[model samples]
Target: MTTAIVPDPEAIRPELAQPGSALPVPPQGLRASRNAGFTSLRVGVTALWLSVIVLLPLAAIAWQAAGGGWQAFWLAVTSHAAVQSFQVTLSISVVVTILDVVFGLATAWVLVRDNFIGKGLIDAVIDLPFALPTIVTSLVMLALYGKNSPVHIHLQHTPPGVGMALAFVTLPLVVRAVQPVLLEIDRDVEEAAASLGASGPKVFATIVLPSLGPSLFTGAGLAFSRCVAEFGSVVTIGGAVPGKTEVSSQWIRSLIENDDRTGAAAMSIVLLSISFAVLVLLRIVGGRAAKREEKAA
Candidate 1:
């Protein structure tokens, strides 16, 4: 058996190690050390911030909810008022989510595909809800659609009023989510499908809808979540009408105001559970969408 020998590169290229040659400024080890330090610092700061701002508060709410024991918690969450609030919230949120998904998609399409006068203003106005205070938003809705002579529309102090208010605040979530996805979609595919005798709707349903499924789910889910906890918007327009329009958040606030901390905590825990469920569903749907895209690709 014979073995091959490796050549000494330094011996063959003496100029490679000549003096006064430039080297890395801080050396690799020192650079790595600094990078590691910076990474550790960033992680530490992020963990600390999340712990103090988010995790700790959620843990505290859980602890408070647990203090009332299982039976009391159940009663608090299942009492007629609580059940009514949940029903009202869930029902209206369903309607609101449907409306948001439909109109939001239309709005996104127009914003991306249409060129019209004041398009820039319309686009900027889409974010107005995000910047405006919820109370202010409520007031604006009430003025337009409330019991008045201007529009001859009276949705004030009703479930429809509450739904309109929520739709106003949450429409932006759906629009923004779908807008970016729309911008990234390839128009050539749509054009090619149309040229292939696929009608406009057919092309959109087959070629576009699949790509937008995840974003629609994301935007609709977020809008529904926001609808669940909406307070100020409904407070004035919906008026916590118990079995009619009182949302989960309004009910919780009423509980707190009536000095029922245990009940408040219980209701809060229920809302948290609902949010967690939405999060889980979003994760499952998002994962399935990713797998489908991978398979298609």
Candidate 2:
């Protein structure tokens, strides 16, 4: 009979035989295969989770939005009050986004670069909206800015009040998004550009803005999407004044209260559509900016 020989794993992997480093080591191919399997499993789990939480709910809404057919959906969305709500929601959301971008950037810059008394308190306070309930925020707004206030400034039942409430809720989104990016920015590059005779605005426009493009878009998109469906804060302040300060969420509620489920679904669909469209637009804009960055590199 012929003698049989088998290769030892320790011999195959010399590092495994090293003193104080003696450990079983899988072959490179096996390790790679295991990693690939784990990656696939993780991908599948993520898809399933998102489907259960986000996709399924969105599909249900879209299905309900079409419950009465396209004609009914169109009528529901185009009615006078519905159109007014759309206008108010869109206009306020746009203003909120612009304000968030400008102020969010400034707030993030100060928080990252400047140091002073109460700075830590200000940092924590920026996230207060995230912890506070939206209804409580509205209530606070009513107490401080509503009628019967010591300040004597009433904003209840007004569009600007609604806008202000939205801004308050969304401020943190932009700040948190931009703050990390601000910290990661290379000040040496800015100093280099300045040394090369680049003016302040020129340095910011060239060096700072490009790096911040994606983060700004992310923050703005989140703020816009969240504010679109914001119910508690806006509803309390705007008073659901139809064709005046009424927003999409309030309009949808009114529809449901009036036994118009289909109309409410249709209105909800409109808000979803607007949010989705804006996200897509931002994605495209950001992608193009990234390509430009690659080319510049």
Candidate 3:
């Protein structure tokens, strides 16, 4: 009788023992993965691209702001136009955020929790700002509120007109952000709260509010950023009055138009810094809220 010798399975696949490929072959029934390292490479490339496009521009402005040292940066931030623009921009953004949250939450709740005739039309209308150009929105606002229009008769002197226009421009942002979150929320949870003797307000305050917290903050942060950086819409209706209505973006544009590149760069950096700080704070708060929701779930 003749006997045949067979090599060991492990020895036959010696490549498995190499430094990088130390793992054994995946299960016999499972197919081997192709280019498993490709994911990491793709992530690296994406990160590099973002740094080049976003971070580098930000760094350049910051570098210029610091060129004359901290004293110069301080002056840029505290200068008359800079200070006034900051105050006005921040105040308007806060007001807009509050109003948007209230209206957006209510709108989202109605859209997701109730059924009505023309629901589809209402939903589509919520996103009108997304399709409309910002400049066009400004023009419409100007047409309606620029002293000649009937609506402007009462609102001509007040900031209310500009505020209303900015709100309309940013409405879709808040609604879109909150709608998905509301849709994902469990209807049964609210019903359970009711079954447990919780009243409507109590159920909303204790359950629904917490669930909606992250989305609200996220949306408000985005809306605030958009509003603060807004140029076309605000300028078209705001009149860009330096101490009265000039926003940071318009102020920066004026500086650049006057050929004060250094000053414009400095003002832009200041605006960017403040906006970035606010956005980061919002994101941190949103993260905490998300964690609480996860825990409750």
TM-scores of all predicted structures: 0.89, 0.85, 0.82
Model 2 per-residue lDDT tens digits across residues 123-170: 999999999999998888888778786788888888888988999999
RMSD, candidate 3, Å: 6.1
**Clash pairs (backbone) in predicted model 2:** none
RMSD of each: 7.6, 5.8, 6.1
Top-down lDDT ranking: 1, 2, 3
* Candidate 2 segments exceeding 4 Å error: 1-36, 196-199, 294-297
Query: Residue 247 of candidate 3: its Cα lDDT?
Result: 78
* lDDT by residue for model 3 (1-297), tens: 999999787677866565775666666445433454666788899999999999899888877777878776777778888888888787887888789888988898899989999999999998888788888887888778776886545343346766777799887788888899888888898999899899999999998887788888888888888888887777677877776677788888887899766777888887776689878998789778878868987
Q: Best by TM-score, which number?
A: 1
TM-score of predicted structure 1: 0.89
Weakest ten-residue segment in model 2 by summed lDDT: 16-25
Residue pairs with backbone atoms closer than 3 Å in model 1 (clashes): none
Each candidate's lDDT (Cα)? 0.91, 0.90, 0.81
Off by over 4 Å in 1: 1-30, 291-297
